[model samples]
Structure formats: structure tokens, C-alpha cells
Target: MNPRHTALALAVVLLVAAVAPATAAAPVDEDAVGDLTVTTAPATASAAAAAEAATASDATDSLVAESDVAVFRLNASGVPAEADDDGTLLGDELTLTLRQTASSVGVNETAKTLDASADTEGVAVRTTESAVYVAVDIATTAFQQANGTGTADAGDSFTATATVTDAVTDGENVTRTANFGVVEPSVNFVGGVDEATAGGTVEFTAATLLAPGTSLTIALAPGEGESRTTTATVGTDGRATGELSVDGFDAGEEYTVRATAEGTDLNATVTGTIQAAATETPASTPTATETAEPTGTSTSGPGFGVVAALLALLGAAAVAGRRA
Candidate 1:
């Protein structure tokens, strides 16, 4: 009951407080998944009309007559870690599915099932470090439903949605949708210099509907042989200009030049004629020759001999008449 005993009891209480288990922090929410992004590749078509429609559409077109494929990517950097000591994340239990929505044009697949329990058709999933990608192939019938039975035309559009759900949590899902349409790119010859001379600078300008900053290739196909190619970048105004060297191109020949957008399926072409350079013909030098006048008299005229003989005969005749 003395001061020394009281100091010893206080030290024991402080030691116990320092060693006691710290209260656990709250568990991270399982629904805190990352963003879902949808990207598309160049679409393929079974028929010529489908390909043409795909080229005309600016929006991503995975739609084809037989099947169209859609790609979905998930970024998990924003996701939180689980509360357990293993240090795992909630993305491990995530599932993705892509479904086609009703449109004026019909499409094939209504929905793609990507859950663990189901082996749905035409759906594949690949996972990487904190990221997952889901791909689905939709049939042409799906798009045809909205676009009608015949060949698809320009301005036709199809809609699709991608959904991500957490398998372990109830009512936890995220979705993103995109609309695609048919877009046709146009190209025309903007006219180069009135005359493209041989070994001179030639420039070609074309207008397109593709987005700005897109890379494009301009191919110049002469009447014969392999074609020549030049590169041009699209301007903010949706126009691209490329320069061509007329060194190898034949002068006075017409060539068909095409400008194709690099990333998208759009191209424009024009016909142009290469002008022949003007050539000057040299003047001929005049040659000088001595032209002599007639040197002798003409023999056909009366000669001195003929005149003397005539005079002699006249004298004789006169003398004879005197004698008689």
C-alpha cells in the first residue's frame, strides 16, 4: 500500500496496453471493381454488301453476315484488396457477358454467357495482371433482324451492351454499351497543278470523313506496272494532302490514285493526268550556195555564120541580075 507498490502496478498496466491486439480495419467492399472499356477491331463480312456497309460506318462494326466479334477489357487498378491475410483482390471472382440489343437491323447472338458454371457458345475470356478481356462473336442474323433481310446499306446501325458481374456478391454489376453504324468514306481528285510536268513536284489532296490525326496511304496506280505509294496524315478539318514525285511516272499518262485511311476502313480515290514538259525545237541553220547566171548565148538563135551566108547569097543574086 506504499508509493513504490503503486508505481509497480502502473508500469504493468502500461506494458499490457502496448501488447494488446490492435482493432482490425474494416474490410474493403467487394463491389469496388475497375472500369469497363469496349474496343473493336476491323469487321469482316461474308458478302460484299456487308463489307461495304462496314466501311461506311464510323462506329466500331463487329457485325457480319455470319458472325461479329466484340472485345471487352476490364482494368482493375482502382479495385480494393480483400480483408484476408492472403492479399487477394475481388476481381478474381468477376464475370463478363456481352449481349445484343434490339435494333432496326437484326443481329445473331442475343447474349453471351461467360459465367464459370456455364459453357456458353462463341464467348471467350482471357485474364492478365489485374485485367480481364472478354470477346464475343455475334451472328449476322442478329444484325439482319434490325437492318432487314436483304443486303445492308449505309446509315444502318446496331447496338450492343457489355456487362460485368461479381460472382461472390449479390446485385453487383457494371455495364457499358456502344452503337455502331455504316459509314462510307469518299475520295476525289482535288486537282493538282494544271499540268504535272515530268521531274516536277506533284501534290494530291483528298477529303475523308475519318477522324483527324489518322494516318493514310495514297497509292498511285499508273496504267501499267506496280503502283506507287505515299503517306499522308489527316488534318483537323478531315482532309489529307500527299506529295508525289513525278520522276518515275510517265508524262502525259493518266493514273488512278487512291487515298486509304490507316486505322479505319475508308478510302477515296481520284484520276489524274501527268503533263509532259514543254520541249523547244531548235531552228535549222541556212546553207549558202553560189548561183551562177547563164554563161553562153543560146545556139538556137541566129548565129553570125547563118547571117554571113545569107548576105553572100544576096550579093550573088544582085550581081547575076546586073550581068543579065
Candidate 2:
């Protein structure tokens, strides 16, 4: 072969090698290169307070609200041959995207992207109307706290996508959806009797709209007597009727009644006065007795006594006339 032809053939072979990698089909066994997984925390009602507390307080033992940090974790394993052990794939670029699906603060906003590269992690936060994005160098602290102000409300919802470029193939991504709004369980009395009579029963209905089928323990505690207890179950209507005995209670006694839902932080209480029934006294009955006959006294009618006295007087007059 001529020298020029040989040189041209070598150039063609080199050019083909460079373009082959870009145009090659995706790997048949994707897992051999690596795997990516994501996890996120559930939303809670206290998210806003937690976020605010974390920002204002520097104490390590500070009370961290569950809603304050909507945590998200990215786990990667079996990285491609071209990557290092630090999870830096082809271009050393990993991205996390957060899109607001629902917001109680205002209208839904656009999606935000956070990029992590070379052992450095990214943070995208919207504290106010404006957006704030930052990149920090940390590995163990991949998910520090809830990313933004959108987590401040219980009615907020979001979708997060964690993506990596040039992993086993071109790209690999995982998604997670979460809501910030959480309904806090609560319990209260519905049309409960305010007053009860001693030695009787007091009826009441407990309501827990957010927690149906919850078991309730109802108790009536008088200030001076033993406490009475009963149990009931919350029905589909979010209510349960319960009755407690007010026996052994004194009249005019003040009592406290409580209804607590089992296995939950929900409870209600009510106060009432106890009234005792009035007592009645019976009247005494007269007894019958026999009496001895008194001198010249008769058991006959009044007219008979008068007639006998007149007859005696007439007899005495006749005797006097005869004597004269």
C-alpha cells in the first residue's frame, strides 16, 4: 500500500473509535454499573414552627419539630467503572429537583434544581418570595432540614426528583412526592351534660373528627368521692356516647369529667355540679287504748247522761215529800 493510503486508513479508524462510545447502545445489565434510590420524610402540621425554630435558635438541644426538616436521602451503589468511589459519575454531576405541586402560602411555583458535584452537596431553599440556592461541602449530612419556605404550611405539596447523569447508561433518576399539610388529631365533648345528680348516670358524647374508630376512656372524678370510669369507641360519625356513674357523690359537689382517646394525644374535659335528691319525713300515727269507767261516768250518748241526772233529782224530791 502507498504511504498516503496507509495514513488515511489510520485516520478513519481513529475517528470511528471516538464516535463509537457516544452512539453505542445502552448497557444490557444496567444494575452492574450502579443503582440509585431516594427516600423522603412525611409531612407534618408543625413544619413551619420547626423551620422557624431551627433558623432562630443555635442550641444543639433545641426542640426540632417534625415538620421543620422534611428530609430526603439519596443512596447510590455499584457506580460505573469510569466513576470514583465518591459517587462522582461521568461529569461528577448529581441533581435534585423540587417542584411545588400545591401551596397554602400562594400559587404554585416553578420547579427548582439543586446540583451536587465533587463531594459537595447543593441546597435550594425559598425562604420568602425570592429563591435562595447554596452548595455546601458535606457527605454525611446529605439531608439536613426541609429545603424551603414551602414547607412552612400544612397545605403544601411537592415532588422531588433525584437524578444523576452518565451513570450505568445516560441517566438514572428517582422521584418522591410529599405533602406538608397534616391533620392533627383532636378530641372534644359534643352536647355533654353540664350537671348530674348523685347516685345517677351522666351521659356524654365524645367527638374526634380526625380520628375515627379510636377508643375513648371516659372518667368522672368528684372532688370528694371515688372516680367513675367507662369506655366507648369512636364511630364513623366521629363520635362516641359514654356514661359514667355519679354514685357516692355528695350534693352540690363539683366534678371534672375527661375523655381521652387511646394511643393518641387527643383528649377533652368538662366540669359539672352534682345534685342530691331531697329526703322526706313520715308523720306519726296515734295508738288506741282502753280506759277505766270513772265514777258516775257513762259510755252512753250525752242525752242519756242528762236524762239520768234529771231522773235522780225527781226521785229525791218525791222522797222529801213522802217524809214531810
Candidate 3:
């Protein structure tokens, strides 16, 4: 071979030797050559936070719509209403309170007073020269955020009231003179019996006063194992008595009696408890009772005893006189 060809051939042989062994290494054990991978994950959960914040370059911009902010309600107090003597029962039952709150769309777009008063104002009534009172010290209020804005918290609501007055009195039209408020009354219920042949009469004691001329309806429910309801009328002194129909009671089992009034905002329904005494046995029939007859006697003094001797002597003197 020519000299130049020889040198070129040697260079080719050295290059082949350098790369041949590595190429023939049988495709390297792919299982032994592990892939380099990096992964990261959180072990402990992060603390619950009011406002979560994160500073990531690229963040997922997706939204999953759940129920829009939610709201819950609670009424710890009672409703207020006002009505007139025209057979009107004016008042409210829905309390103005909120237990939970959630986000809303746009401004608080409420139309009617009831809608606006979902958690604000409560039901109210107006009367011509009449006022209504509502008592609710048992209600609670809570704060809620609307889209993190409008807050709902407790306010001074102890003196809530409603009023009604004459719209036109003496030819003078009045605007609005009615007001309402909250009030509490001491409630009392008492009753025993009016005339109890079975157990006698039923008596009731009531404390909370209704408006003058307000008829208080009290119910006398037969105690356990009783069959009938005996009703009574409340009197001026908050007392009521009426005849009771004794039925369905065990002879020896005393009846459990109770007097209950309806519930009102002023106070919970008043109630009184009593027991029907066991059946009382009547006294034994009296025998024919005869009044004793008075004895007859002379009314003369000790002279009555001497009268017999004097009579005998008189008779002897009479005989002597006749003989002479």
C-alpha cells in the first residue's frame, strides 16, 4: 500500500477501536440506569386560615362554582304585632335575626318589607290608637359577611315596638303615630276546682294580665288517665273556677291536673299544676234522728210540797164547821 494510504488506514483503525467497544457494550443495562426525576409534595396539611394567600408565578386560573355564599337564620326573640278592637289581630311572627350569611349578587335587591327584613326589620302592625308589643330576649344575632363587605351583627333591639293610631280623628288626618316595642310580663296559672263532686271544682290562677277586656282562655286538662277537658274563665283577681267533668280516672289513681294558657310574646304560656284527690267516700247515711221530748214539771216553789198538808187540814176544819 502506498504511504499516504497506509497513514489514513491507521487513523481509521484507531478511531474505530476507540468507538467499537463502547458501541458493542450490549445496549447498557437499561434497568440499572435509573431515570433522574424530581418530585415534591406536602406531608402535613396547612393550618386553616381566614384568608389564604399564595405567591406562585403561574397559578391555576379555574373556578369551581359551589353554592354561592350561604346564609342561615335564627330568631331568639318573638315577633311583634299591633291591631285594633275591630276584631283585628295584628302582629308579626318572623323574628329579625340572622344565623348565617353568604355572598349575594349585586346590591341587596329586596322588594317588599318582608324581603328586606329577612334579617333586618321584623313583622309589624299598625292600628288606629292601638299599640303592639313584642318580647324576644331569647333570640340571638350573629355577624355575617356579604362578599366580604356588608356585615350583619347584633344591634340594640331590646325595645322593638309597633303602634297604631287614628288615621283620621276629628277630621284631622294623622301621618303615623303608631309605635311598637318589646315587653315581658310575669306569667301565672292557677286552678284547683270549682265544685268537685268527683274531685270538686276547678280553680285557676293566672298572673300575666291581658289587655283590659281581654278574655283569657284557660284549659283544664284532665290529669293522666282523664278523658275530658274542663275549661274555666279567668276572673278579675286572676282566678278562675269551673265545674270539672270527672271521667276515665282510676278509683284510687289521683288525676294530674294542669291549667295552661296559650303562648304569647310577653311570656311563655302560663301554666298551673294540680292533682285530683282520690275519690272521697260520702259520710254514712244518718239514721232517723229524733229530737228528745221535754219533760213536764210543776212550776211552784217549795210551797207546792206544803200545799197537800194545808189541804187536808182545811178539809177537817170544814167538817167541824158543818157539825156545829
RMSD of each: 21.3, 21.7, 34.0
For candidate 2, which ten residues in a row score worst on lDDT?
A: 130-139
- In order, the Cα lDDT scores of the candidates are 0.50, 0.47, 0.30
lDDT tens readout by residue for model 2, 1-324:
999999999999999988785544443233332222221111221222322322211211111112223333333333233444555442343455445443432544433222333343322221211111111211122322235422322243444454434434345442322222323445677674667877887888876643333467888887866777888876646678978877777789899988765434555778989977767779966544344444566638659878888999999999999999
Q: How does each model score on TM-score?
A: 0.42, 0.36, 0.28
Winning model by TM-score = 1
Judge candidate 3 at residue 40 and give its lDDT: 10
Deviating ranges (above 4 Å) for candidate 1: 1-31, 42-70, 75-103, 106-124, 128-131, 135-156, 168-171, 182-197, 201-217, 224-226, 230-243, 248-252, 259-268, 275-324
Candidate 3 structure, TM-score to reference = 0.28
Give the winner by lDDT: 1 or 2: 1
Higher-TM-score candidate of 1 and 2: 1
Which digits, one per residue and each the tens of the lDDT, describe model 3 over residues 1-324?
Answer: 899999999999999988784431122122222211111111111111100111111111111001001111111111123222343333222222222212222255321111223223222221111111221111221233332323221221111222111221222212211112112323354443332334444444454333111234444444453344554444434344544455443334444344433332322232233444666789986555555443345525568648877888999999999999
How does model 2 score by TM-score? 0.36
